[model samples]
Target chain A: MKKTKYRSQSGNAFLVAVSAVILGLIGGAVLMAAIGSNPFMGFYYLFRGGLMNIERIGNTLATATTLMLVGLSVAFAFKTGLFNIGASGQMLIGGLCATLVAHKVFLPRPLFLVVLVASALIGGALWGVIPGFLKARFNVHEVVATIMMNWIAYWSIYYFVPAYLKGPSLETESASIAISQSLRAPWLTKLFNGSYINYGFFIAIVCVIIIRFVLDKTTLGFGLKAVGSNRWCAEYAGIKVNRNVVISMMIAGGLAGLAGLTFYTGYSRNMQIGVMPAQGFDGIAVALLGASNPLGVLFSSLFFGILQSGKGFMNAMTSVPPEIADSIIAVIIYFTATSVLFQRFWDRIARRRGSRRADQREEE
Target chain B: MWSTLSSIFPYAIAYTIPLLITALGGLYSERSGVTNLGLEGLMLVGYFACAITIRLLQDTMAHSVWLLTLGLVASVVAGALFSLLHAFASINLQADQVISGTAINMLAGALTVYLARLISGSGNVRIRMGIIRKNIPFLSKIPIIGPLFFTQTYWTTWVVLAIWALSWLLLYKTSFGLRLRACGEHPSAVASAGVNVHRMRYFGVVMSGALAGLGGGVILITYSGEFHGTVAGLGFLSIAALIFGQWKPLGILGATFFFGSATTIANVSQVIPSLSVVPPVIFKIFPYVATLAALVLFSKKSAAPKASGQPF
Candidate 1:
């Protein structure tokens, strides 16, 4: 009976998410109609734009690769009851480290890649751990700390990129890293038919699997979840809540750092200053939609990836504008994030149905 | 040297108004027990709405000040309305406050941009003359402080100062203020005292939206001179001020001034040769670095209303 109750609860969460997405879509369609655009054609072009060609599919995957890691980062932190809004900052730091490595470090090809990956992980973890430490030691709210961290990171990049990695004739961005130094390999490029798809896609998949294992199968994951559920109760249970908070942030930061590596070293192959990564914030929505589950995040990241990549094409192909796509995505995220209300509604209905069935049984 | 310092004064004052208003806005909600991370988003929505309204009214309205003032009112109303999303999610839905705020921020930026695109055929809503500076004939002739504070006229500066005084009075001197403060520190106790916690929180959040909206509109006409798709992280800076001020209106005002000076220095340092030894980016980073240091120092000693971020 307990198992059945748990299953139903999870089922309810899923149903709530679905209903939210449907609402988002309906709301978006209504907006489109209000704007004198045909919602059906707009959506048709939106999906087709994302999936119409092999190169487009590859671009979508490439976009999904960074989002997947960032989503996993946020999801992991969310599970531990941490809001890691500094994912973008961590991504910047990690990407900066990898960019430095790409320019300065020369090793055998495989060894170089390994070093780049490690530097990114360490850099991101450093960014993540500061807020974690503050939250643990000083009881500072992680949200405020992380936001401050983000600006600090932004300025550091603004200073560092131009000072250290300025490209020829361009003051805005770093010199393009050599393709050999980046995640893009000849074989993978050929397999994708010269698409942007690279090694980060596989790395994201591996990270997802590892996170699922850690969250579901490890004692550390259990401790993190326990603390997330209730810090005082977890302490009473002999779980060191402070220590778990730090660990959760570090792992989350490391994941976001990997996203940085994929984005700078794989997808774009260069770094730009003065832009906060949109993926860091977008990952928050992705995590919420996925209910902060590892596998669910993996899938939702791909879905968002489709929406993002398809948005430009939809704007080009239809009367619907580009900003409208952003609005649609934002509307979807808003609905999904508030899905707790929907869950409560579902729980009430389920309880009523169960009570009614019990009464019917008694009457019989 | 005093003259140079005075030259930077009005600039600092101009920069502080929006931050002061927004931080004060944040204080209202948090003091009533709702952690409003959505202030950043609320400000953006306010700015966007103000810009659109000013643009629409420029031809219809006879005077620029009237148009700008109307825009300010529109922003406040819009901000209050938009903040209802956060209030609903956090209060009624029992959603995580941070997540709800994040969603609000995202929704505001995207929704505003989308609306602008639909209405204006461009993502940017712009106006040229809504921002104005005026001088009081007698007040402008005062001493060293008068030349510093009175010059380079933006009405937002004085307007915000007036609001600040009023808000301080409202937060400290009134019976409603006592109840709002009580709700944050102990909602259950407030409820037991026959005060409705939900109503107080709703009041806090809506008032925050209104003030923050005005803050955003002031920025559009005063500092930015136009509306882009973003607030350029000024919203987050206001959040920092709210925390640094330790959630008090006067404290937030001081914090905003401090940050305002930092930004003033960053903007003017390029022209000051002695200060030019350091790269511009270092100055650009100073405000954020200062905020972090302030948070670290104040975090442990925070006298925040205990029930902040609570669902009740």
Candidate 2:
């Protein structure tokens, strides 16, 4: 019975996520048809755009780098029952720190990358911890606080990128980081055949494994999860609920900051002002689609990465506009985030099937 | 000095109107126990709808006043319709309210831009509206108070003020308001009292949508003359005001005015001799900085609805 329960839980999670993807695809297809395009052709190109060639595949993976880290940041916070909506701010601060280190701090290759990564992590942690601290100490809602934080970070970049880190001619973004100082390792870039893939993917993989282990195996993870599942109960059991909340958000912010490090230093090569990273908001969808699991987040971010990278190609190949592709992605996220609705749907079907089988067995 | 203060005062009040409308919209949903973070999205929908409708009517309408009034109504209707998605998801499916609201915001943003591109073949919705500044005939003659309060004000400002009065009366002086507030604080108690908690919650959320949507029209017609597929985070800023106001009508007015002045200074600070030295970005950051400070300072004293964000 215990084995069945375990099997069923995993099975249910798998089924729910798969069904959501299917529903999202169907919704995308309908939107495609609405625009007088062939739905199958649209999807065919959508997938092919992401995977048609070695270079395309590499670009897709590269795009996934920041998303993967951001996804994990959100998922980690979800486990502690805290919504770290400030991931965008964390990413900005993290990326800003890394950008500063890349431009100012000169060192050997290995040492330089280590300093860059560490600074990004610390910068992100600082951003994340403030909201957690506010929540713990002052009862401020993270959602409101984080939203405020996002604008501050956005405007800060608007000022800082132009004032201090201005490129030779462009006023919109910071000066580009040197190739050697960046997270993009030469060997990995060569392996991807000139695609934008970087060492950030490896960090994401490591983070997933570490986060999974911490969540499932470590006492710290257990304590955070316990606090999340029921703070009052965890408090009664002698856990420091507020401390766990702060730590959870700090780590979550650090992970998001790492995403920024990769995004600004590796993927896009520089941070731009007047724009907040969409990846921060997209991370919310990634966590929801992944059911707030690290492994699930990895896969979901990849899927989103493909959709985003392939969108330009899809627009080029089809009459359907790029905004249609975006709307389709948004629709999918809408359906996926409402997984509770799907769970009830599946449960009803299961109940009916089980009752029918029991009736036949009673007759026998 | 008084002239500078008066010059800034009207702009502050103009900005305050939209924030006041949106914050009051937020108040309704929160009072009914559903955390409607989707106010941003709903406002976007309303703004987009009203802009499109007004842009279309501008070609035919003989008078601008009729066009603006009809556009405001269109926004409210569009906002109410859009909010049903949140109402259904949170009330029926019992999805996490914040997540649902965030999804609505994302969807609103993506959908509005996509549709606008398809319809207008442009990146933004532009409306041709000159500032319809009014000087109240009787009041404009009343010395210092006259020009600051009555001159150069749009009808939207008066409309929003009326809404605040209406909202206050409905919330503090009516049976429906009592039941609505009760549902947010304690749904079970309301249910036991024979009031339908879900229905009350729905009304609260829909009213929020209507008000937020109207706020969208006000912002577009009064503050700016175009729709850009974004509400500039006014929704969240209004949420800040809602918190600082301690969920009361008059309190919201003060909070909205406080934030409005911050934004006004940010926009016009370059002309002010003392503020010119600071980067305009610093001015832009002031409202958000104030929001964070307000949340931190007021979160403790603010008595949020007991069961807010919980599904009935």
Candidate 3:
């Protein structure tokens, strides 16, 4: 009976997620039709673009790597009942740190990689911790604080890149890092037919496993979840709610930092000024769809990665703009935000099913 | 320094008007117990709608003034309609207002760009003409105040300030305003008093959408002649101003103007010899940094609406 109850509960969540995705796709279709584009053809090219060749698959995975980390970052915060909307700012700071390390540091390859990754983690954590600290100490809203942090990072990059890291021709971007210094693994590149796949994919997988284990098996995880469910109750039960909030934001920021590292050094091998990585906000959709679970984030990130990686091809093949992918993602998030509508629909179905089962038992 | 001050004053006011109107919109929403974090998105929707309306009518219209007036109306309508999505989710659907607002922001950013790309094929809509800045004849002749406030000002600036004044009176001096504020402070009590909490919140949210949309339209007419799919974070900046102002009408006026001055100074510092000694980044980041500082200082005794962010 307990197992059935758990199954049904999971089933309800799954249904909600699926419905949101369906509605979002329909919304995208309507948009496409309104613009006089063939919706079916657009979607076809979009999926094929992400999966047509081994190289494309590798690119998709490479894209998913950054998204996965960002998703985990958002999901981790969700677990502690905190919203880390400053992931973009955290990513910028982390990427800046990683870029610095890539340019200036010259240790042995393995040692260099360790330092590179750690720099991003620390950078992201520092950025994340400021808002966390503000929220904990001063009761400031993290949402507004994070928004401010995003702009600060944006303007800082606007000046810092031109002053310190200007590339050969463009003043808008940093100098590219050499492949050896980047997250590129020769073996993986060769395996994927010279695609952009890098060591960040492995890092994402490891993070997923570690996060899963921590959330399910550790006392710290229990305390965090307790605080998330009910902070007042958790405080009464001897949990340090403020400390948990800070720690949660820190870990979340660190994860987002890794995302930045993977994106800047591994996928692109450079950073561009004036671009707020949309992946940060896309991560919110991933976490929401994943139901804020580690495993759920992994799969959802991969799904979004396909859409993101495929969009350019769709635009090339059809009159549809590449922003269709983003529009769809946004629609999906809106539906997810209004999931209470889905909950009612699912509840009504469950009630009917339970009543039918009761009738069957009476007949028996 | 004095010459620079007068030279910079008009631009400062131009920058402040958009933020002031948008932040005022935020004030209404928050005071009515809904945290409309999607003000940025709503502004974008207005910005886009105005751009499209003006773009379509520019060739057909004889007078630019009438064309611009119609464009602003389109923006207000589009903004109010778009905000209904946020209102429905946050109010009727009982969704988390912050998440819903975030969704609104993302949707506006993505959807506007998508539609713009389809319409213009380049994702940017450029207008042939913008609102001409002119001196208020008699007012411009008033020694110090004239040159600083009345000269070279966009007509939209005065319109927005007029709206601000009217909003202040409506929010402070009316029974309806009292009820709206009451809903934010104690919705249950307001409900018990026979006020429709949901209806009042909807009105507040819609008002925010209209004003924020007008703010976006003002930005396009006054300084930006192109719709390039972004307000460059002005919507978010206005939100910070809303907070800095502690959700008050007069306070928002001051806060937005402060941010506006900082922004104008940052923008023009490259050309101004006296200010060029200071790094442009410091000026650019000043408003955001000050907002964070303001939040920290005021959080101890925050005047945020009591029922704000809570779904009715």
Candidate 4:
């Protein structure tokens, strides 16, 4: 009976997530219709723009690659019941470190890759470790600390990039890293007209798989999950909860840093400072919407990528500004975050139905 | 030395206006247990709303000061209304508070840019006649202190300080203050005593919206005296100030002034002959570095409300 009830609860959770997405899409369509565009055409364009052409597919995949890394970053923290809001700051620092290594150091491609990756990991891990340490030792709320750190990271990078690495001449951007190139896979390079369908996508996929493996198969993962479910219980079970929290944060920060590298080295080629993209915060929504599952994040990140790529076509085809996509995403997240409420509501109905069936059976 | 001190005073006050107001806004929400990350978004909307309203009513309002006042009121109303979206999602619908706040931030950012373009018929809009300075004759006539305190300070600075004092009184001295604190510290206990948790949270969020709006208004009318896409990040700085202030109204005010002074010093050091030896960016980084240091030092000892992030 307990197992059956648990299965029903899982079923209810799935139903809630599906319904929320459908409701969000319907609301978006209604908004498009009100804006004087045909909803059908808008959706058609959305799919076509995101997937119909090779270049578009490549762009979608490229965008998804960074989002996947960020989603993993946020999910890793969430698994340990920590909200790593500093992912944005960590990503910025990592990007800065990667750029400095690539631009300031001269080495063979293989050695450079190792150095850049190490710098990115160390930079991001240091940033994440601050909040982890604070939360572990001082009981400081990670949310407020991480949020403040983001601003510090942003302005510090803004100051440093212009002062030290502005190519000794330029006004707004740092020098492009030496040997920076797109990470396109061989088959994708031919399939996508030389678009940046790079090795980073594969990296993102591997990272996701590794994260899932660690969470499901490893003792460290068990400790993290146990701590996330209940700190006191995990501690009573002989888990070093504080260490797990810090390790989880370090892993999360490393993933976000990799995201920055994927963007700079695999796509943009320049370390653009001043404004880190909103990928870190957006990862929160992606993680939640994906239910914090690594595989779920892959699909959700792809969905977000589709929305981003489709926005351009949306602007071209209608009077709607591309920003309408952001509104749609906000609405979806707003609903997705409230999915527990929906699950409860559905479970009550299901229970009522089950009870009535049992009553009928007893009467017979 | 006197001249340098006097020159820096008005600039410090001017910079403090937005941060002071927004920190007070954050205090309202946080004191009632809702952690308003949407303060920045609310401020952005207020900034755009004030700019567009001022642009439209500049002729009929005749005086820039009145127009500024009108813009402030409009922004406050708009901010309160905009924050209702967050309050509804987090308080009523039981969504994740952090994600709801972030959603509001993204919406505010995209909406501000979209609205600015729609209103100005372009991507950017600038005020024609910025806020005009006004002085009280008697207050402007004192000795060395007068120039620093009264002569050059904008009316918004005084208003901000007055609001800060008012918030302190309301939060610490009144029955409403007791109830609000009770709600934040233990909503279930407050509910058991027959007080409404949802209503207090709503009130808190709405108040945050209004104050943040005023903060945005001050930035537009008094400091930058214009509206742009880049203005969105100042609200985040205000959040840092709130935390650095340790979530107290008076502390927030002091932190605001500290940050304001830091910013002014950074800007002024670039102009000083002796200090010009240092790169301007170092000065630019000073406030953020201070924020980081303050967070490291003070946050460990600060006692946040018990129910601060919980959605109850």
Each prediction's TM-score against the native?
Answer: 0.95, 0.94, 0.97, 0.92
Q: For all candidates, what are the clash counts?
A: 1, 0, 0, 3
Q: What is the TM-score (0 to 1) of chain A in model 1?
A: 0.93
**Model 2 C-alpha lDDT per residue in residues B193-284, reported as the tens digit of each score:** 99989899899999999999999988888878888878877888888788778778888898889888887887888788866677778767
Model 1 over residues A300-347: C-alpha lDDT tens digits? Answer: 888888888888899898878776655666677777766766777888
Distance from true position, residue A325, model 3, in Å?
A: 0.5
Specify the CAPRI tier of model 1: medium
- Residue A275 accuracy (lDDT) in model 2: 76
The ten-residue window of minimal lDDT in model 2 chain B covers B294-303
Sorting all predicted structures by lDDT, with the top scorer first, yields: 3, 1, 2, 4
Residue A46 displacement in candidate 2 (angstroms): 2.1
Quote the TM-score that chain A achieves in each candidate.
Answer: 0.93, 0.95, 0.95, 0.90
lDDT of each: 0.85, 0.84, 0.90, 0.78
Q: Can you give the lDDT of residue A351 in candidate 3? A: 96
User: What is the Cα root-mean-square deviation between model 3 and the actual structure?
Assistant: 3.3
Model 3, A1-364: lDDT tens digits are 0000001125678888899999989998999899898999989999999989999999999999999999999889888888878899999999999999999999999999999999999999999999889888987877788889989998999899989988998989999999989999999999999999999999999999999998889998999888777789999999999999899889999999999999999999988998888898999999889888899899999999999999999999999999889889999999988888999998999899999999999999
Query: TM-score, chain B only, every model?
Result: 0.95, 0.95, 0.98, 0.94
lDDT of 4 by residue, A1-364 (tens): 0000001124455577576677768867876776577888888877677887888899889888888988899888888888887788888887788877777777766676778777887888888888888777766667766776687788788778877778656777887655442333457667887776776798899999999999999999999988888789999999998899789888998998888777766666676666757888778767867778898889989998898777888677766666666666766766776676677778899899999999999999
**Best candidate (score: lDDT):** 3
RMSD to truth, every model: 3.3, 3.6, 3.3, 3.8
Q: What is the C-alpha RMSD, rounded to one decimal, of candidate 1?
A: 3.3
Best by DockQ: 3
